[model samples]
Structure formats: C-alpha cells, structure tokens
Target chain A: MSPGSGPHTAERRGRPRDSGTDSAIIETVLRLMEEGATIGALSIERIARETGVGKATVYRRWSGKDALLVDVMKSLEETAPPLKGESVRNDLVSCLEFARRRGLAKRSSAVLRNVLGQIHSNPGLWGQYQETVIATRREAMHEVLRRGVHTGEIRPGVDLDLLSDLFTGPLLARAVLRPDGSLEEGLQEGLSEQIVDTVLAGVAPPPVAGG
Target chain B: MSPGSGPHTAERRGRPRDSGTDSAIIETVLRLMEEGATIGALSIERIARETGVGKATVYRRWSGKDALLVDVMKSLEETAPPLKGESVRNDLVSCLEFARRRGLAKRSSAVLRNVLGQIHSNPGLWGQYQETVIATRREAMHEVLRRGVHTGEIRPGVDLDLLSDLFTGPLLARAVLRPDGSLEEGLQEGLSEQIVDTVLAGVAPPPVAGG
Candidate 1:
C-alpha cells in the first residue's frame, strides 16, 4: 500500500473535515436560536450563510431541517455514561445525578435553554425530541425501577411508570416549572442522593412481622 | 338624588363599563399571542389595532403590556377552589387533581398552551406569571405536604419542598415534556388519585412491629 494512500491518513483527513463542519453548523443554529430566531422561520440558506458554508454543503450532510435538528439535539445531550451494575440505590443515584447535571447545564446555558424553550412551539420538533432524547432516558430510569422490584428493593403492585415519575418529577419540577430557583447552588448538590433515599424509604415493603 | 343616579344603577353602569372593556382587551391579547405574536414585540398600538379599540381604551384598563398580560393570564386560569381540608390525603389529591384539569385545559386550548410556551422566552413575563399565579399554588401544595408531615402521613426529616415537586412533577412532565401523550383519555382519568396514592405509599411511616 502507498504511504499517502494508507487508511490512517484517509481516516484522519475525513473525520475532522466533517466534524468541524458539523459542530460549526450546529453551533450557528443554536446561537441563532439563542438570539431569538424561531426555528419555524429559519431556513437553510440563512444557516449556511451564518456558518460560511454553501447550502449544498449542508444538504450533503443532512437531508432536511428536521433531520438536522435531531442531530443538533444529540449534540446538546452527551451520550449518557453506562450505569454501574451495582445495587439499586447506587444505580438510581447515578440515574438522577445525570438529570441533576443536565438540569445544571440547562440553567447555565442560554443557547440550550432557549432552544429547549422553543421545542414546544413546533409540534413536529417536539415529537422528534421526545422520540430521540426523552424516551430513551425515560426507559432507562424505568428499567432501574423494574430491577429494584425484582430484587425486592421496591414494592410490587405499584405502577413502575408512575413510580419512576415520582423519582424524576422533583428534579424536573425544579428544572422547568421553577426555572428561576434551579440556580440555587445549595439545593442542586446531593439532590440525586436525597431523591433516591427519600423515595426508597417511602416505598419499602412493610417490615416482615417477627420473621 | 335622581332615580337614575341611585347606587344600584350607578354600580351596574360602572361594572360592565370597565369589565366589558377589560375582558375584551384581555381576550384580544390572548388571541394575539395565540396567533404567534411574541410578547416582546407586541406594543400597545398593535394590541389596540387588533382589538379594534382606541389606544386610550387599553391604557384605561392596564398600565402597560406586562400589567395587561398579568390580567390575561388570570383569565386563563380560573380561581382555584378551596381545599376540603378533610385529610392530608384528600388535600394532596385535590392539589394534583387541579393540576390534571390544568393539563387538560392546556391540551384543549391552543391559546393558553401557546401563550404558556411563549412565557419561557420573555423573562419579565415569566417572573410576573410566577409571582402572581404559580407562587400561590406552589405554596398551597407545600402547605399540604407540611401538614402531612405534621400529621404523620408524611415522613419527617424529608424536605417537604422537594417532596411536593414529586407530586407536581409527573403531571407537569406529561403536560410539557411529553406533550403528545398527555391527551390520552385513560391517563388523565384518576391520575390525581394514582399519583397521590403512589407517592404516599412510598413516604408512609414503617408499621409498628409485633406491638
């Protein structure tokens, strides 16, 4: 094989060339949104102009606006780290701590916060977001609760769907419903542990009488 | 006094004179927001034009746009009913049930839902909304949880503020985060009972052992 034509150089040339363009395009969209450009009103021509790329360059990477938006959301949420196959308590804490960090990030980021705020205005965008991002995270939390039930850590006969919401609801309430207060530094730290321990204490099975 | 100048006639004349204009102005604002007019862009002149009223007519009712918006939001949410105060369980159910209806209303009414979606975009409007509508309801729910703790229905040593979020969060999650699913007929029915019972079971005190 020729040295210049080797796979290593081919790989190096291709990866950065594409990703740098991808992130630049993505950042431009987010910045536009933060500056109050509604997604419904933003067109590809405008985006390419902002990103200093030809419109054809964007079309080559993404088929359409919705497709590009899905990728943009993926950029916003880091791929979740794998859960430790530990006790349910530890696993649950890991799950909620992920949410805590995400909540904190939302508070700190104007672009992300504004982009998220815009999701509700466009039904198509919201549906795609739920399918791509929210559903996966929800299922992971549900799986943790199901495991807890199997191990007798959680009470049987309760709706795991609703039970999972109890665990997630408090954190989200602070995130969306009470956005102003989410910046409280004291409350965010250890919030995951507090949620897990408190809910587990409530749902634990009645002590086996004189066993 | 002349018969036409009596208090009853004067009161009737005054009541509808202001309120008819008030509600008409409020309705115009809501309709404008529903039609995709951003609160930040809407000026008194535009609102007056849309309402088919003189500019002075609007100023006669509200001091400014924010003040007008405050009244518009008030029109969207009906006055909350007094809680029965029969038991903490009953009160919590009452609290969540109100949220259920609210979620349902947001689903059915495009104007209310769209306006709420717009609230996150403008910080001043959101702050006023929180101060006027949200803070009152939140304090009421917190009081219910505190009473539960006092009466032994809720576990002591848990943060009541966070605990209240658990109750409110699931409903809001369905309402805002998972907007598509909130309309299911089955999920809406008995949701308040399900959430309250499920969370209560988790937070209940341990039974006395072999007493």
Candidate 2:
C-alpha cells in the first residue's frame, strides 16, 4: 500500500491517532526480528495480528515491511549513546563498551545476526542500515581518532579506517561467533580492556630519538 | 545409515570404489552451499537428484544432512595451507594472506557466509564446524604466537586467544560484511599490511630502557 493512500493515514487527518497502537506494532516487529525473523518473512498481516492492531494501523505508519524494519533499526541506533571522553583511549573504550553492552543484551545479537544474514540479498535495507547505524558509529569513532592525531596522541600516518576495523572487529566477531551467554563476565571485560590497550599501544607515536 | 553399512564402504572392501562419484557429490554439495543453500534445504533426495545418483548412493556415504555438511566443512579445512614463516610477523601475515585469498575467491565467501548464518541455530553442525575448521586454524595461529613469545618478539604476557581474534577478525569481518569484490586490490593489500603492522607494533615488548 502506498503511504499516502492508506486508510489509517486518512483517518489520522480527520481524527486523533492512537500512538499506543503505533508503538505496539513497532515492539512486535522488534520482538519478531530479534527472534530471527527476516523482513521477507514478516508480513504486514502477521505484524498487525501479533500487535492486536488492524492491518490499516500498521500500513498507516509504514508503507511496507522494509519501511517498518528500517524504522526499527533506526530506533536501535537512536538508543545508542554518543561516544565522548577526555582522551582518545577513553573515547574508544566507551564506544566499544557501548557495542559490548548492546551485544550482550538478549535478542539484540540475534536481531543483528538475522540482519547480517540477509544484508546481501536486500540492498535497500542494507543501505538504510549502513546510513542509520554503521555510518553514525563510524563517524563518532573517526572524530576520536582525528582528535587524537591533532593532539599527537596517535601517530600522524595511522590509517583511521583500518584502525577502526582493528579496534571493533574482534569484539564484533566474538559477539557473532560465540554469543554472550557462553562467555564469562570477567572474560568480556578483559577482552574489552585488551582490545583498547592494544589499539592505544599500536597507535601511539614513537618517542623522539635521544630526547 | 551407519557408517560401516554404506554401500561405498562395502564396495571399498570388496572392490575398487567410485572415487569419481564421491568427488562429484562433494563438488555438487559445495556448489549448492556456495549458492546460499542451507543444510536443511539440501536434502539427500535433492543432492542425489542434482548429482544424478540414487538416494541410496548419498545415504550410503552420509548418514544425514548434518554429516554431509560436516564432511564438506572438513574438506574446506583440509584445503587450507598451514602457516609457516621465518619470523612471527611473517607467519601472521602469511596466515592472514591465506585467509584473504580464500575470501576473495569466487563463491567461497558465500559458502562461509551461509554457514555462519546458521551456526547459532544448529549446535551439532556448529560443533563440527568448530572442531574441523575453527580449532585447526586457531591452533596454527597459536603456534606462531607461542613461538613469538618464546623468541621475545611478542610480549610474554600477551593474551594469545584475544590476540588471535584481533589478528584475523578484521579480515573475516571484511569478507562477510563488505565482500572483497567491492574493494580495490590495493585496498585489500594495504589492509592486510596495516593489520599486521598494527598488531606487531602493539604486541612488541617495551623498548629496553635507555637503550
């Protein structure tokens, strides 16, 4: 259904809208997604039924399943706190910690895994995910690295793009491959510290000879 | 079907076995897997039909789909060359280079991606993958790291498990998330070197004081 022609949208213009139903639909979508349901598998009818709302209610907010999924992913991105700290190391640790907490959460990793599985098959959803989620996170990390270089805390020639991957990739790989329920709390904390320390040490500028 | 009861096994004991048929089945399985077919989707009936063999032929070789997949993954593991070099850095670079070349190969990444998607869902299949694929690779990398520590190339207290992830995770992540086709050749080479250099610099023991 086109966004402009949906019956619920027309009703909204004539009368007050039910915000609760809107949230209910979104929550249902998130829960299903976290349970490993793909976008193609989640029909609007199923979502509306699961949410105990009419089909028109969902169609009013989202034109289709892809639109709903994009909205849900955006909500996740919005919930993530921005990265900021006194030093580059602190900033990186905090940013990584943010990712760790999210990864450790029940359903979050499953939701991400489901998305990663189908990302190649669905370019439109992938593009939205990149823009709303990945691009924003990368931009925050880039700012920290840029500031570190400006302050001479990091070597001038370090490739920030590669460095970013090095810093985040292990943690992400662990989350996806091993999942959180299997790991001890101490191990998780240790891994975070280890990754941060390694990156910091790697990027530190060499001391001037004979100083 | 039990392993000992298979017609192929019986034939092996009585007369010359059809090595060509065995290879043909494996090749068809790999091709289907690389095209994003799931274990559940690849029934013995389908595989036999695709290979122009009877259901009894496939059943005689593999007890079930999981067994077949495990065998396929083992075949992939056997194909990976062992890491060897004059120094720890060289060993690591070579190891990662092997992974890069494999990732860049047509259809290989797709097969890996397809497996990764279902790893969390199927514990039996996952255990086989871990034993046959992940453990072997990690052990080789561990040997190189252990030698590095003994030679004082890497610091003594470095966490080898976490270090292994740090070394290989970015490459794997890039293969799955970005896929090598989209990246330029120079970028791939540069990334491999950057990862190696950053890791080597990060893990080197502190310079001797006042040296």
Clash number for each model: 3, 0
DockQ of 1: 0.35
Index of the highest-lDDT prediction: 2
Against the hidden reference, what TM-scores do the models get? Answer: 0.78, 0.83
Please, what are the lDDT tens digits per residue for candidate 1 over residues B129-149?
777667888999888888888
CAPRI tier for the interface of model 1: acceptable
Candidate 2 TM-score versus the reference: 0.83
Q: Tens-digit lDDT track for model 2 on A1-211?
A: 4554334654677676777766777788888766656554468999888877678778767887767777777666545575566777888888888877777765566556555555555667767777777777888888988999998889998888788888888877677566535334665666677798997888899988877
Task: Report the Cα lDDT for residue A184, model 2.
Answer: 43
List the RMSD of every prediction in angstroms.
7.5, 4.5
lDDT of 1 by residue, A1-211 (tens): 3453222333544464567778898988877765645444579999988887777668878987767776777778777788886899999999888877777663223333434445544557667777776889899988888888898898898777777777888887787666665735685688888778877876777678658
- What DockQ does each prediction reach against the true complex? 0.35, 0.46
